[model samples]
Target: MDRKRVNACIEEIVKARKADGGLKQVFWVAAGGSNGGFFPAQYFMDRESKSLRSQSFTSNEFFLAPPSSLGKNSLVILCSMRGTAETCDAASLAKERGATTIALYIEESKLTEVCDYSFAYESISYDETEASEMNASYGLFLAMVLLKKLENYEHFDLAIESFSVLDRVYRDAWNYTLPLAKKWAERNKNESVIWVLAGGPAYGAGYIFSICNLEEMQWISSPTVNTCEFVHGPFECTDKNLPMFILISEGRTRPADERVLAFLKKHTDQNIYVLDAKELGLSRIDKRVSEYFNHLLFSPILNNVYLRALAIAKNHDYHYRRYMWQEKY
Candidate 1:
């Protein structure tokens, strides 16, 4: 994951911040799954950084109306897999605004050229389940490293050490989750619609599966419901005719997820497939930072097992696209 390169960039940011005393704001900009990838970093900065302000924006929106506070002391991070044109332009705009820009991409492209520094997450060049190299993991790591360097986070040492064991823990999680993922896919593969529910860090994984995996890849009508927002309006569709893919994350907002889960089980007859984070046994991660990593733990299950099985069962290849590259928007 190029931890050394990430460390160098954060050091450089620290140096720049010290020179001007203006490293208070961070903006995460990207599109689609790449935008989802930076959610953890924004959430982390919101929860942990006492002096830092963070925001996440879809690339086009960022280009259209950037925050007025986005200059000098700000850090703009643009993430993408192929470095889509919109995101690359966003990187250029960020650079032009005098913000220190970083591009977190799976590969180097024109977007990387526009940034002050580029770090590869290596999502494509990885095998099986690259625990420390997932999209969200890299963002979280960068946040951790930045906070650790900037403010001397007490548990950062243990959290950094935990990465050494994450791959092994990830393998165990994959093995444990595979059977249930396959079971859920086999039982509900023919369902016409699905409500994918998640909360906290795992929300991005649910977002990816619903938008990128189910709707875009398998041509299924899948809408994502945040567990925190489920009771507001989405819970109205609580009948036996509907199916739900519920994710119970292990993090700050887990109680919200649990509350919605309890309500769903009691009031609805819908076929519910729950992927509880507790069952994944992520004890190998340091307790101080474990909760922040629920997204990484849930990713392999969603990507390789649940989503893949459903695509196979529905006779659709995940790579198939109707109009993504074939038609203009």
Candidate 2:
């Protein structure tokens, strides 16, 4: 990631602020896995920003019907792994609307070219860099930097301090989760549906794990529900034999997740595979802002370690798609 470019882009936006106002709203626009990756950012800005509001939009939705509030005072961050058509079009529309656009993508393509600012958070050589850098981490960092500039976010320094030890936290998570993920794969390799539950900052990890890793990559049936909302109606599906993968976030909403877990543990069989931030050595980062890093800590374990093991157990290639890239949808 080019920290200098990111700083410069946000700096320019703040410097050119019109006398009328500063930034008012932010639109996190993307599709599929990329859209899910923005959830942490949406959650962060939703909680942190006092002068600004934030919303997430699937790419075509933004292209077809962007918010009326999307004007010069708005900022739109669009992401796509390969710069897909829908996302590129959304970036174009955002640019046409006179909003400052930031494109987060792994490679340069049409979307990057059209947006006002572009950051390649990861590249072909991303694996050679720190284990902490991830697509979701980029989204969160953008929010952190923007908030630091606008509101002088109280925990800003602590947040940056958190980043420094993320590679450490990530390594610890991997070492701890490796044996557990292997066991998870062996357990759930044959299950038809493995429900995933999480909320708050950790929601994105669950989203990507369910939709992107399990369904899209593994061809498994995995539906996700926010932990806080599971009790409202989804609780009816609970059964002793039902398999679940519950991720516990360290944020304020953790109690809500705990409530969901408590009910599931009693009603369901011992099939609830769990990963908690408290289990990982995330204490190296300050607790004050540790919530923001939960997804980052959970991501590689979910997508890289667990799902890859599941793929091997099922004798399926993670990159193989029966329908997706093979056809023109």
Candidate 3:
């Protein structure tokens, strides 16, 4: 909703470029529900970043794990929109271990003070609960800025254009998916558990942030799966009454996707939902560009949509900033 804040964060990241001293590795850490899940995916797929190594860490016990875990020359980018204490503690530890520390927080806070550098997006809070959406968008901006600093972006203009495209996509998704997502939430309310499916990178995505956070939010059992695995094994004896959500990305996976759709059709008794940019007819991209963005940004957007719907369904009155800090540090 606040494009200016997102743009400002992006600009700061671009301006902060220093020769990363032959950067070798990166530890991209995020705390919170959706961010913890999506940040790693964003970091890895971002070819512009000089991150030879990357991983997502969740457990507090591992937060202090030796910096050598990321290798000698690692840059620790601690991401927490709400400036969670555990993440601040992790940043402090990473810095003490001689790893360069950076933080992406919603505002300048204690976490920023603990890091070598801090990027604040959305300084003026909107609705405290949904602020994470803004925080997530700012995180994406941070990723883009980091790339601009580290890589020779012949496509800087293109990247800016891509932001506009992304904004439009989010708007469209908000319009179209909300009603359907709410409907699905209603239909699946009685189910004891929900299965979320995506494949390949999306497979990694299925477990990354959103679904896992949804588990915490809804207090319902949610398991993520790669559609390929579901077809290989789980699909064999799935009961009709089960609920599963499929996140489809555009690519050669099309044929495989057809197979999935066919299978879901065959098992019409199962409560199933598909979230995809192309499937939703929401993205504006040429074929080549479509394939690329779909592979990267598509699932995260879908995940956001699902999260928003889940928040509404649960009547948690979810305020993003309310959960700003986790107590476990």
lDDT tens digits, residue span 1-329, model 1:
77888888899887877777758888889898788777778877788888777889999999999999888899888899888999998888888888999888777899988898877775722465477887777888888888888778777888778776777877887788777777887888788898899988788878887887788878889999999999999989888778988888877788999998899889874688788887887655766787777777776667777778887777778887989999888
Q: Residue 43, candidate 2: how far off, in angstroms?
A: 1.1
Write down the TM-score for model 1.
0.95
RMSD of each: 1.6, 1.6, 5.1
lDDT of 3: 0.57
lDDT of each: 0.82, 0.84, 0.57
Candidate 3 has a TM-score of 0.73
Best by lDDT: 2
Candidates 2 and 3: which is better by lDDT? Answer: 2
Better by TM-score, candidate 3 or 1:
1
Ranking by lDDT: 2, 1, 3
Model 2 C-alpha lDDT per residue in residues 1-329, reported as the tens digit of each score: 56667778887887775543878888999998888888888888888899878899999999999899988888899998889999999999888888989888887899988988877766312345464466777888889889988889999888877887888877767778888888888988898888999988889889988998999988889898899899999999998788999998887999988999999878875899888888887666777888888887877677767887898888889888999989998
Reference-based TM-score of each model: 0.95, 0.96, 0.73
What is the number of residue pairs that collide in model 2? 1
Return the lDDT, model 3, position 112: 88
lDDT of 1: 0.82
